[model samples]
Each structure stands twice: as C-alpha cells, then as structure tokens.
Target: MGFCGGCAKALLIVFNFIFWLSGAAILGVGIWMIVDKNIGSYFEVLNLDTHDQFFKYAAYILIGLGVFVFLVGFCGCCGAIRGSKFLLGLYIFFLVLIFAGELCAGVLMIVYRVQIEDKIDDALESSIKKEYGESVTITDAWDVVQVQLDCCGGNGPNDYVDSKFVNKQSEQMIPLSCCVLTNKGTAEENPKDAIAKNGTACYDKLGEYYEKGCKDGLLDWGKEHTTILIGVGIGIACLEIFGIVFAICLCRQVDREDKY
Candidate 1:
C-alpha cells in the first residue's frame, strides 16, 4: 500500500476497534434498560396492553442496532487489515444505514418529546389512581419509582387521597414505598426490602412521607444526566463520520493499486 493507503488502513483499524467497543457498550446499555428495575418499571406501569410502549420499544431497537454495529465494525476492521475492497464496501453500506437510522431516531425524538412527557405524566397518574394495588406489575412499578426517586405518588402523597390503593386499605394509608425508610439506601436499592422509619401509615404521617412528586423528581433526574447522554451521542456521531471517510479513502487506494 502507498503511504496514504497505509495511514488510512491504520486509522481505519483503530476506529473500527473503537466502534466495536462502542457496540458492546450499546448492547450492555440495551440489556440494562430491559432488566433495570428502576427504569424498566416506569414503562411497565404504562401497561403495554393499553398504553404506549415507548421505552420498551427503544430498548429493543438499541439491542438490534448494537448487534448490527458490532458485526459491521468487525467487517470494517478485517477489510482494512486485508485491503479487501468488497468487505470495505459492505462496511460502508452498513455505516450509511446506521447513520440514516440515527437521523430518523433523532427526528422522532424531537417531534415526540413533548408528547411523550405529557403521555407519561397522564399514564402514571392514572396507574396510581386505578392500577396501584390492583395490578401487581403497576404496583411494583410505582413502588420502585417511589423508593428509587425518593418521591411519592404521581405528584405527592396526597395524590393517593382518593386512589383505589388507599380506598382498598382498611383505613387511610399510603404505600410503604412513600414513607421515609429506616434503612436509608437499602429500600432505594431494593423496594422489597424496604422498611419504614415508623410503623405509622404514610397517609397519617404527613411529616414522614416524601413531599416531592415522582414527576418532578424524574424531571430533575433527567436534567442531571442529559449532558452526559448528549456528549456520548455526539462522540459516537463523530467516530462514525471518521470511520466512513477512512473507509472510502482506503477503498480508493485499493482500486488504484489494482488498476496498475
């Protein structure tokens, strides 16, 4: 290979290795999203049978894209090392497809961002009012959210005033998840192991329950982490762009050598 070709090959190999690592990271994230009690519970409360499965759908997409990227990175690295035009071309095609998919996903996120927020708010409130204590999945979801976010109900402990969960109890009461825990971090870590600071029901002990609402708490959490997410996204985009350019340059160099 010529100097330019050799440089491109080396860069391509390095970029593809990074891409492969990223793919694995994405896959791990996807799996985490699926299994994580905290985040996964949020969508489970939406009840896929009746409500939008937005988060669940996103996790599945991530998994599929991650696998695709992993294989494409392998192809690109092999193609660059072997100086094979065919593999390089195939790698480029997959990159283009991934870029398009990302563009579409970004557009969809922009368009539905507000709508999703509103829907999630409504769905969560509805679940607390009607599904809590009735549906095991939704009950668990709310418990997890309340414990993890250090918040209560859709808005606050008051949100359960006329809720089915409260009405069903022998007397006015709120979920233990809404109470101040005896074990500070354990309940947040595992709701099933949650222990309230006192035996008193959260409904009667206004001072003991979390004043913050889950909705506001969730918004605050998102704000705190948004910057990290954005930075990672931009970094990935840059890497992909560089990978495409290097692949194309190397392809041309291979063609030039073959023509001679």
Candidate 2:
C-alpha cells in the first residue's frame, strides 16, 4: 500500500519548505560571515585553529550542507508534485547519511583530546593580599592551574578536569592530574555534590566565571578566551545545517515511500 496522500504528504511538503528556506539562510550567513571580519571566529572553530585550511574546510562544509539541504527540499517538492517513488527513496537514504554524519561528528568532538594549555598572563597587583599574607604574584601561570571540581558542573571552569571527574582513565592508568591536585594542589574533579572540596593550602580558588563570584577573574578570562567561543559557535552551525539537510531528505522520503 502507498502512503495515504494526506497527512504524510502535507508533513513532507511543510518540512521540505522549511529546510529549503533554511538551506538558503545557512548558505547566506556562511558566505557573509566568511567575508566579514566579524565572522572570522566561526571559521576558526570550523577549522580548529588553522587559518587557511580550517577556513576553507569550514566554508566548504557549511556551504555544501546548505546546498545539500536545499537540494533535498527541492527533491521533496518535485516528488510530491510528480509522485515519484524513486526520488522519495533516494531522499530517505540521504536523510540517514546526514543524521549519522552529524551525530558522529558531535560524539568525536567531545571525546577527542586537544591538550589545552591555559595561562593567565596578567599578574596580580603587588599590594594584593591573600589569606596567607600577600597575594603572591607569579610572572608565569604555566603550572599555576586554577582548579575546580565541577568540570561538568552547572557551569564549566577554565580547566575541565575531565581527568579528575572519573577514575575513568585511572582505573587503568595512574591519574596524573588527580594525584597532584589532591596531594599537592587544590580542587576535585569529582567533587561531592553536597560538599565542595576543602583546604586552602591546596589553594582551591572558588568562584564561577560568569554567574557566580570572581567577576574580575571571569571577565579577564572571558576576553582572553573568546577564541574558544568562535570554534564552538561555528561547529554548532555545521551540525545544525547537517540536521536541516536530514530533515529535508526525510520529508522527501516520506512523500515517496509506501507505509506511514
């Protein structure tokens, strides 16, 4: 039995229309951003720091995804008008591919280790005082890590102690981070929800960058760490455009297939 020529067709047509429109929008934004100085950040994230290679890859992928989505939408529209089952089936296959690709990319992004090195270049004022006595000013913050437990907390820290979060790796390997942090330094990767870790000698610097305390520190970090935001925003856009393409294909398939 073929698809009932009412709800399914209507659904497909609606989604196809939306995706086609979105495809154009994505392409437009990507193109404008590529040219605009303001949009350079997105390119960097998409490329992962290589100005030339990443920029090209990011631009191509974004534009391709948008165009693919537009094609899917167009196919759906044509299939609906012509009632072509082959076009519909092809659309369905493309939908699966697009969805799988985006899902895989997201998973890989989270799991991949980039070996981030964070440094606070600004020195505390000479007169600044700490509880110990005077806030010691270290010229280089290379080893001076500002620690936090809630790596995956309500908000994240400059340092994501995914290392400290679980015995995940330590179950097999000796956790390099936890040993120093717990023994010599301050902070917990897997902090007790009820209790935040204690001890000042360990030098636990408490405070959120955005919503909580340490407004100045957070502000400083914010301005300095804007590059990260660039990568994240563009990567997200790539995933989203991929999704739009999938939706378009799915709509077309539903229009062509037999069965709801």
Candidate 3:
C-alpha cells in the first residue's frame, strides 16, 4: 500500500514540537552552563526521559510535549507496520523532524567551544604586562617572577628589595624573583608585586608564562567538545538508520485501511 503524506503531517508537526522544544530547552541549559555554570539541573539526557526539565519550571511543558510526541510517533510507527499509508508516512516524517534538530545543535556546540592558543596567549600577555614591570621573568610553567636588583628603595610603596631564599634542604638560590616589596612584607604577597612601578611590559612578559597553564586548560575543553560532538553525531546517525529501516519496512507492507 502506498503511503500518503497528508496523514503524516500531524505526526511531523508534533515531532517538530517535541524536538524543537527539547533542543530549545537543552540550548537554554547550555547557555546557562557557558555563562553562569552554577545552575544545577540534568534533565537533558538522551533517553526517553532525556527531554525532561531539570530545574526549569517551564521545562515541564516541554517534557509533556516531548512525551506526547514520542507516544504519537510510536503509535504511528506501530500502525505503519501493517502498511497503513497514513501511519507509515507520518512516522517517517516524525523521525526526521525530531532527531535532525537535536543532532545539529549538538554539533554546533562542539564546534563553537574550540579554543585557540594564540588568542589565549595574547590575552594573557596583555593582562600580565599591564600589572608587572618589564624585567619579570616567566617560568616555563607560566609562573611570573619579577626580578629586582639587590634591595632598591624608591619614594613610594613599590620599592624592590633583594630576596634570599633557603629551601627546606638549606639550599641557597638567590632568584631575583625573590624581590620584595617593602610596604608590608608578608609571605603571602609575591615579591614581584613590590617591583618598580613600571610599564605593562612586565605584565605582558609575565602573562606569557601564565598563558601556558591557561592555554592547556582551554585546549582540554576544546578536545572535550570535539569528543562530545563526535559522540552525538554517531548516536544521531544510528537513530536515523533505525528510523529509515522502519520507514522502508512500513512502506513495502500490505495496506491496512482500519482506523484503529
């Protein structure tokens, strides 16, 4: 029996409502995660209940809509099994509308979250140099250490003093980074801050050091997004495959004219 597209229209409409709402809700959550990151809710899983709302009151509506869509789609597919042209056509459309939106949003998120090291490095350098002096040295791990000549005094708060360090082993390393600011010398403050009130070159130089750590963290996030996108893609592909198989089987079956 030939499948008619008209019977499928209602199912397709419902499917869109389900998928669009689910996607929209998930998008809202993702947006929250990007900006605030403190909202604690996890209703956007990928199962039948994946579309449920976590903390959002409005999510209840979406969840209900999604449930209704899935049920209707399920019933339509069952009817399609007996070659009800209306049923077969509607179920096929339902699968396409529902899953397509979900897959696209997931893919886009993975792409947009990628991090570029150069951009991160530039920001680090700009912020760091604006704070420290030109002579600050950057450790390989991105630690910024301001170098001072043997304790030097100036008219103001930022006088650099020579720093001497004896490690737990009584080892001596006279790192210029040990420079001290004379105002209120507490061990909590880094000696670098006490350096001469110089230009941003110091912060910029120091920032290079900081960038290493920040960039590493950012790259890790980029990699994670990539992996998630890949996983989502694979899952959607699988679902589409199943949906297509069901659609094809329904199309070739004998026609059932009964309304029930």
Candidate 4:
C-alpha cells in the first residue's frame, strides 16, 4: 500500500474507533432501559395484547445491535491496521447486513406511521383500567409521566373515574401528581392549594387537575423531536456507507500490494 492507501487506512481506524464507542454507548443505554424500574414499569403500562412483546424485546434488540456493531467496528479497525483481507471482507459483509436492516426498518416505520398513534391510544386506554395504586411500579410510572408531561390521564381526568384505583377509593380523585400546584409548592405541603385555580371539578367535587391529556402531550413531543431523530438516522447511515467504502478500498489495496 502507498501513501494514499496508508492515509485511508488511518482514517478507517479513527472512524471505526468512533463507531465502537458509539456502540458501547448504545449498549449502556439498552442495559439501563432494561434494568431501570421506572422504564420497566413504563414498558409494562405500554405493552398491549396486540403488541405485547414490542417494548420487552426492543431493549433486547438494542443490546444485540450494540454488540454486533461493536464487534464489527473492532474487526474493521483490526483489519485495517493489520492489512487483513479476510477480516476486511467480514467487516464489509456485516456493514451490508446492517445497512439493509436499517433500510427495511425505515421503510416499515414510514408505512406504519398512522397505526403507531392508534396503537399508543389503545395501549394507554387498556393500561388505565388496571389498579394503579395496588402496584407501586404502575403508580410510580404514572406519577413520573404526569409530572414530566404536565398532563393527566389517557384522554383527560375523566378517564380515571372508571379506573379500578379511583373506584376503590371512597372519594373521587385523581393523583396529586396531576395537580398544578400554587406557587409551585409541593403537593404534600398544601393539598387543597395544589389544585389548579381554574381547574374544574371531577366527580364528588374532586378537583379536575391537569386538563391536557398525556396522549396529546406525548404525540406533540414526538412531532417536535422527529426532525432530530431523522437527522441522526441519516448521519448514522452515512457513516455506515463510508465505513463500507473504506473497507472495500483497503481490501483491494492490500491485494494489489501482495501481488508486488
């Protein structure tokens, strides 16, 4: 290999190193999602009969992809540095597989875009019917969601009236997390004042806290972040293309050098 080939090899090493690090980060995120109680609860709530295993298997798939990418990146780096044609060929094969998988995934997401919203709504409705207070996990998930999204219920506070938890309680009420507190005081500090000033009444004169439903809030959030997600996806795809090209070039250069 000549000067240009050496430079290409060096660039490949740097790119593969970065790719390996990214894979490591993805693996860490997958592990965190799987182990975090809040995430587990959130997945449990979202899981539906139609898509019972989607969330559960998503984390596992992420971990698998992370491991695959990490191994491929490592092989690319080693192949480039050691001028190994066999390892370079292996790296190219994996890159093509990954690229094809991503392309299919992107196509599927586009085709099923409308169904995604319907599925989310159905899952949310199904989740709300269960006993929220009985399970600490479910309760915690709901509280965090309400607080973070600043919203109530699947559709509205009314959705809670039919909930097993709300029906079990003597007084008709929503979770304190739904309330928009005065002066941002803690719900424990002033339960009465925690209720929003303009909030309407639910059944039995219980304050109708947050008017906005999580469904809209979550959908809006997704809409806002879609551009960023697309950009990241494109960037990753470009990186994969570049890796494949460099691997092929290096492999050819190594072959030519062996003939000389």
Candidate 5:
C-alpha cells in the first residue's frame, strides 16, 4: 500500500506537469489569435457589425480558461507532492467544471451545425454591404482572406460587381488582391495591367481571377482539416480525463491512508 501511494503520487505529478504545459499552449494560442492582426480576421469579418468584437471576446474567454487550467495544474502538482488532500479535492472540482463546460459546448455545436452555414453567409453579406470598404479594419480583413485563400468575394467574383467599393471605382475594378497577377512586376505596378494582358477588359478577365468565393474556400479548407482537428481535440480531451482520474485516485488514496 505504501508503494502504491508513492506510485500514485509520482503519476499525479507527471500528469500535472503535462497539464500545466497544455494550459500554457492554450494560452499562447489564444493570445496569438487575439493579437495576430490577420490570423483569424477573415472569420471575424463574417460577424455582423454590431457584433464585431465577437472573436476578440472569444479569445479572451479562451485565455481566461487557460489561466484557470494553469493554476489548477499547479495546485494539483503541489498537492500530489505534499500529500495534501485539500488541494487535490480543489483540483478535482475544477476538472469537473471544465469537463462539464466542454460537454455543453460540444452539444451546442452539434445542435447549431445545420444553421451555421446560412448564418455565416448572412453575416458576410451584411458585412460587405454595411461596412466593407467604409472601414479600414473590414477592408484589411477581406484583403487577407482574398490573398490567403486565393478567393475573390463572399460567394464568387461576381459578388463584388455591385459592391460599393467596386462601383465607386471609375474603371469598375475589384480589389487587386482578388486578381491573379501574371505580370512579373508586383501587384502595385499598374494592378489592372498586372491582372490581365493588354487587350483583356476588366469584366472579361474572369479567368485571370479566382471565380470561387471566400466563404466556399474557407468551408472547403475546414472540410479538409476536419479530421486533423477532431483528432487533436480528442487527444486533448483524453489527456484532461486522465488527469482528472489521476487526481481523484490520489485523493482517495490519501483519504484511505489518513483513516488507517
């Protein structure tokens, strides 16, 4: 029994160390998502104008959870090392709370999955009409999406034809980011010419640009990466469950020893 207790303590310490590192990684990712100007800006732009801060708030929430996890991990480590049942109990409570929250989130995601695409399209269309070129933030966000995904508008190149920004241009031009430059020079070097050969008209140069929209491009990317994401998510959840079980076992061992 003495040897069993020692082994449990060692396992708890090792698991807690891993949990601490995971928390740090989560915090780092959250901070990167929040501060890296172009990182998730495309998705952020899809939110309605009144809810523009949605992504920022979500990042903050993730950071908060990371901090909580980090602190709990530290508590668990100390409790296991010192044979303190109180700290282990506290860690168990926090683990349970986090597990419940994750389960709820997973359920909500499944419940809303069917409506998500329509909501995304509505938000993107609203953003284009209400705040596209009018705001520097919106314009930069869209530019990032177009350049990164090699996509044009929300649904396709034609989605921009009647947009305020394109209409305002004297020559009826989409953003240079939407164009695929065939010229050896940079896109800044007479962008219209860069997008097409000498005789190609702006509207007729459809082949020179991505016909697919950013929304579809992003959806396709998500579909491609879904398997990898699910694997990572499952791995993390399993680690958390293992940590919780270890903490509980350690606490029970401590209690039995104290009673004996």
Candidate 6:
C-alpha cells in the first residue's frame, strides 16, 4: 500500500508538470493570436463591424483559460507532493470546471463557424462599399488578404466598380493590391509599390489582376487548415482529461491513507 501510494503520487506530480507546460504553451498561443499582425488580418476578414466582439472575446477566453490551467496545474503538483487532501479536492474541482468550459467553447466555435459562413459575403460587401479606402484598418485588412491570397475585391475587380474607393479615384482604377506585378522593373519590387504590368487602371487590365475573389480565397484557406485546427483541439482535450484522471486517483489514494 505504501509503495502504491508513492507511485501514484509520483505519477501525479509528473502529469501536473506536463499540464503546466501545456498551459504555458496555450497562453503563448493565445497571446500570439492577439498580437500577430498577419493573424490579425485574417481575423479582420472574418470580423463583421456589428460582430467584432467575437475576435476580442475569443482571445480573452483563451488567455483566461490558460492562466486558470496554469494555476490548477501548480495546485495539483503541490497537492500530490504534500499529500494534501484539501488541495487535491480543489484541484479536482478546477479540472472538472475546465473540462466543462472547454466542451462549451468547442460548441461555441462550431456555431461561430456557421455564423461566419452565413455572414461573410454581406460583411465583405459592406466593407468594400462603405469602408474601403475610408477606414484605414479595413483597407489594410483587404490589402493583406488580396495580396496573400492572390485575389481581387470581394468577387474580383468588377466588385469594386461604383464603390467608394474607385469612385473617389481620379483615374479609373482598382485597388493597387489588385494590380498584377509582372513588369520587368516591377517584378522584383514589392507588390504594394509595383505598377500594373498591362495598364495604369487595374479595371482595364483584366488579365493583369487576380480574378479570384477574396471571399472564396478566405474560405478555401480555412478549409486547407481545418485538419491542423482539429488536431490541436483534440490534443488539448486529451491533456485536460489526463489531468482530471490523475488528480482524482491521487485524491482517492490520499483519502484511503488518511482513514488507515
């Protein structure tokens, strides 16, 4: 019995250490998502003006959960090492709470995915029509997407016609981001600064601009990375479950030793 208890305690400590590392990793990822400019551009594409809270809330939740997990892991290690029944019980409680919260978050993510699919077109149209060239944030976001995805406007250069950006231009033009950079002097230059290969006005140079629309480009990009996302989610869930079981078993061992 003494040997068994010692083994359980040692295993629990090791598990908690691993859990602590996982928490730190999650925290780092959460912070990165919040601050990374490239990632922020992707979020901007998904974020509708009226539904902008989603991105902020998602980041906050990740940060909060990461911190909570970090603390719980520390508590779990202490409880196992000192054989403190009270601390063990508290650790178990926190583990269960985190498990439940993660399930809820998963469901919420699925719902958010659906909502994004339904509203993305409308959001893109609204941004192009009213915010393009007018809102620096929106314009930068669109430019990033257009260049990275090799796409034009929401549905190609035609989608920009009669829009605020095009209307305000002195010459008939699409966004510089839409222009294809293939000229001898421009091919090596930055796409943002490169002139169009065929003509100055991007709308007239149909062959010189990307015909793919950003709307489809964004969706396809998400699909390409779905497997990675799902794998990460599953990995975290397994880690949480592993922590819960270890804490519970150690608590039982402690209780039996106390009664003996």
Q: Poorest 10 consecutive residues of model 4 by lDDT?
A: 184-193
Q: In model 4, state the lDDT of residue 186.
A: 52
Best candidate (score: TM-score): 1
TM-score of each: 0.87, 0.42, 0.38, 0.77, 0.81, 0.86
For candidate 6, give the lDDT.
0.73
Candidate 6 worst ten-residue window by lDDT: 183-192
What are the RMSDs of all candidates, in order? Answer: 2.7, 15.4, 15.1, 4.5, 3.9, 3.3
Write model 3 residue lDDT over 1-260, tens digit each, in one string. 33543334333344434444444444554455434311111111001122234434444533454465456556554654344666767666766765675577566645544433335445444323332233223221122212211211111112212211122212322222333324323312444344423224222233111111233443454466557646745664465556555555545443333432
Q: Write the per-residue lDDT of candidate 5 for residues 1-260, one digit (tens) a residue.
A: 47777887888888878877777866876797667665556455665232347657767877888899889888888899888989999888888887776566555544544455658787777666666677777776776677667777787777666677766764645666676656525433223244443324434554566677888776665444433434544565678798788888888888998999
lDDT of 4: 0.70
Best by lDDT: 1
RMSD (CA, angstroms), candidate 1 = 2.7
Candidate order by lDDT, highest to lowest? 1, 6, 4, 5, 2, 3
Residue 11, model 5: Cα distance from true site in angstroms: 1.3
For model 1, which pairs clash? none
lDDT of candidate model 2 versus the reference: 0.42
Model 6, residue 44: displacement in angstroms?
A: 2.3
lDDT of 2 by residue, 139-256 (tens): 0111122223211111222222332322233231211221223333232322121222232311233321222212233334434544453454445445445544544544555555
Instruction: In model 3, state the lDDT of residue 167.
Output: 27
Q: Which residue pairs collide in model 6, if any?
A: none
lDDT of 2 at 194: 21
